[model samples]
Target: MCWCGIAVSQILAVRVDLWNNGNLVQDIFLGEIKVPVKVLRNDSFQAWYLLQPRENGNKSSKTDDLGSLRLNICYTEDCVLPSEYYTSLRNLLLKSSDVQPVSASAAYILSEVCRDKYDAVLPLVRLFLHHHKLVPFVAAVAELDLKDTQEANTIFRGNSLATRCVDEMMKIVGKHYLKVTLKPVIDEICESPKPCEIDPIKLREGDNVEINMENLRYYVDKVFREIVRSSISCPTLMCDVFYSLRHLAAKRFPNDPHVQYSAVSSFVFLRFFAVAVVSPHTFHLRPHHPDAQTSRTLTLISKAIQTLGSWGSLTKSKLSSFKETFMCEFFKTFQEEKFTESVKKFLDDVSSTESKEPSGVSEPVHLKEGEMYKRAQGRTRIGKKNFKKRWFCLTSREFTYHKQQDKEPIFTIPIKNILAVEKLDESSFNKKNMFQVLHGEKPLYIQANNCVEASEWIEALCRVTRCNQKRLSFYHPSAFLNGNWLCCKATTESTEGCARCTADVPADTQIEIDGDRETERIYSLFTINRSKLQKLEEACGSIAVYQGPRKEPDDYSNFTIEDSVATFHTLQQIIDIVEKLNESHEKYQKKRSSSAKYGSEENPIVGKVS
Candidate 1:
């Protein structure tokens, strides 16, 4: 197309030839063809050619003849349209007097408009507010606009148009949008202050505000109710909104008890609601604003404690009882640190009093009935014993000791002082078999089983038992029967030695024998000189020779006399006088029998009669 006055770049040029009924009419320059411009839904423009002959040369202009022309044109640059056109269209519709009929179109256009141009449409926003209409459409537009602006982060500082646009946007978008964008706007308002103009009535009435406030509250309440219904749903969003409201309430209605109470009560209810809905394992999302979150938490804790303090008021109602119970638990968890300290101090006090007085003290710290304390006695380690005895004063109610100190005073305090007793599991606590030391043909209890329960038995053993860690030969009693002695070498290897010659005979001269033809017998023999016996008595205070069968008699016909005889004495004179002579044997037997019966009903023996 050719234009006489327009710039060449703006004109469309095309070559064309007209034909009718297979006959060429003429070759002609299409000459400034009027192209039909299309306005795209996105507000972009495109031009298409439709040719017609000049009016001077036209035979007759007819509608049917206009269809014969076909022309091709190319754009000089990229054809993508700018976004400002849509924004302008939106602004026009927003300002138009007849916005109701085309409200959907305006919203759609605004949503499609460039985020940066939202401020440009602020004048149009005033029309919506004045009419008190298009709240939903405006809300959608605002949300879409917010998403765009936040994504692009176009600076809006000192721009009155932008500030009003965002505020209106938040009003339409409801509390969720307000919560998400509040921090940024609050920060802006705090820094600049000029852009955020508070409406006095809206702040005072809150959700009850007229027109736009009602719609805003509806959406906001919907979001909150859903949050209350399930803590798992949008917990972070709920926490943020509640936290923001807490701050906003304080700022908007400072010193107003009613508003403060309403805001804090709502937050407390929401917190408890969340706790009820969420599983114990789920971690509650805290508000992003640390200071606001801390204030909210403290407020809830205080409320819970106060509720617990007045629990007696709720006795008549089921809901009140439930509330009181929840409050008690909440208070307990909230005051955990304080409670722990108090308990520790109480235990310490009891322990100190109990340990102050020794067991033998004539003037004991006497406590009244049900009032008790722990007193620790100084440990006395007698002789060469390694362990010290421990004592404790336990009230009937006391379950277990909590203090871990090695020498803690025996707590004579009431049983209630014990918080918990840790009973070692069977897997952890080792069980030892009990054994008894027997005299000749007489059973004597030596050690009791269940050492954990029998401290006295363990103490006796600890006092008397001496452990020789050095590797020594432990001869099996059956080894002597076969006329052979089993000796463990220094390397701890078992080796057989002729019983008659082995030097490692047990000091006890009594031997237990078993046979099929007779009952089990205790054989006593004089195996040591009087000097050795005297030395043993001096070292251990007293020495005894024990001889007995360990169990009922069994078959012994298969037993062979293996010519086994352990060395009774090292010197020939002592062996001959003690082992070979009948007189020495009778004397030894009489002495043993007398000593066994001395402490019993039998007559006591005097000195050893030679």
Candidate 2:
């Protein structure tokens, strides 16, 4: 048999002939076969073939099967097809499991057509679910289109099929793709309907916005549960999900105290903090993993901490209570001693930093209530024979000493009762770092690491305790007294050092206060101006915008020009401040006038004003 190929601009035809044993017993001319220029479905053309009897002298009417032909036409390039045809092809592929693998191009076309059609995407996804092993289906669901991920997450976040596919994909493709694609869509669907305002003052408006608190609660709980479920099974995805959820919560409900409270409460309820405290290894770096994965997870954990930390500010005492609670629960469940120690250390460190202070300040200026600062190692006199090394911690409230890093303080000195700190006989102990903390009933002789540290400690302590009553009228001038230096500058050289050299305690220590008053003044002004501007913008419903010179021209003259644009709101802010100041003055004048007219109410016998 002979076959001939004919080509045209748009179509190619393959003409076939049939032969029996090469005798040309029958010449069968097949119908014209058009080579597909583009394909809408998996098949390029319909399958068509025929067998015929020889036209020789025998002339038997019964046809003999010589040959049959089948063809599959598909498109590599983009080709539009009806959704029905793509659906049909997908169904056929799913039904024909034993047949050749599903056509990649057909799946691609189906996804491309159904990318935007939610109605069509779900059914396609379901079809792919049955044939996910096929590259075409996998690509359609995960790689080729995002609509599948969105639809799956939106419509069926908890659906078994979709979640299973996602779990598998996360393992196969890693957490990055899930974060960039799937997690956002899920978060969008689960986002709180109430529009969150960045400023707390603006959040007052959201109270009237009508939100379903139950829905918000359910959303947070659901996301938290999913992350917890994946803690062991899908650690990488769990890390990403946790970070994403915390970020969304913090960013969206930054100013909403109730929402922030709810988030913290939810984390506690769901045992999220418990998991974190116990299995930080899962969230943070794994030394055995590659650098990239380690870095990614480490960054994610850090961000998660930051986001959670922003949810609410906890005081040092409250944080200690939380640490105690977490440790209690953590030990109850895991009971790993090593992890317990590490977690306690971590908690101590984090809890110690409960308050965030401004950088570059040498002293803890903004000390929170019960916040410990300036903790260091020092030697305390135990008896005349020995000095014990101890860790000293200073707080606005008290001074404490601890035997170990993670232990509770064994000694405490209240700041309110401490009267004064005096420089001791630095030369007597073969050291220049001795100081005495004079408080109730006795003076405690403490040896610091160096002279500078001793000076700083004494200055800090004196500044905090200068208002207290003097505890001791005079130094005792003795060698030993209740594990303290009773000797006032008494040394071996001098039999009575107190008599030989009188202690000249300064009226004020060398420590300076009211530091950088100019900077503070400028900051206060800026703060006041900012508040006034915000008020003006709120009243006027317009924010001032500054338009600078165009950067494209790069004109040298623009740099020298003094120009700025301000709105009516700018003038309005100044007017508002002036009005407030004037109102204060008027009120002050009215108060004086009333007081003068009323004479002296406190003293009823006083004469009336003339």
Q: Global lDDT of each model?
A: 0.28, 0.36
Q: Model 1 over residues 12-83: C-alpha lDDT tens digits?
A: 422333323232311223333443232111233344445555435666765344444333333321111223
Q: Give me the candidate number with maximum lDDT.
A: 2
Q: Whole-model lDDT, candidate 1?
A: 0.28
Q: Candidate 1: RMSD over Cα atoms? A: 47.7
List ranges where model 2 is wrong by over 4 Å.
Answer: 1-385, 471-473, 476-610
lDDT of 2 by residue, 1-610 (tens): 4544333332433323332234332223333333333332323245554443332356555443444544443323121222432343334334322322221232222222221333233443334332333233432232222233332212223323223333333333233322332243233432323232122333354353124223333333333333322221222222222333333344454554334233223332223333332233232311111122222222323223322332232333424454334222222322234322333232222222122121223454422222222212233333334456666777656777777555798878877667556666644454456776656544566777776677667655643443343433344433343344445533432232252212222222121222223122222232344544343333223222333333343322211111112223233433444344445545755765567554354212222111
Clashes per candidate, residues 3 or more apart or on different chains: 16, 1
Lowest summed lDDT across 10 adjacent residues in model 1 is found at 516-525
In model 2, residue pairs whose N, Cα or C atoms come closer than 3 Å (at least 3 residues apart or on different chains), thus clashing, are 44-73
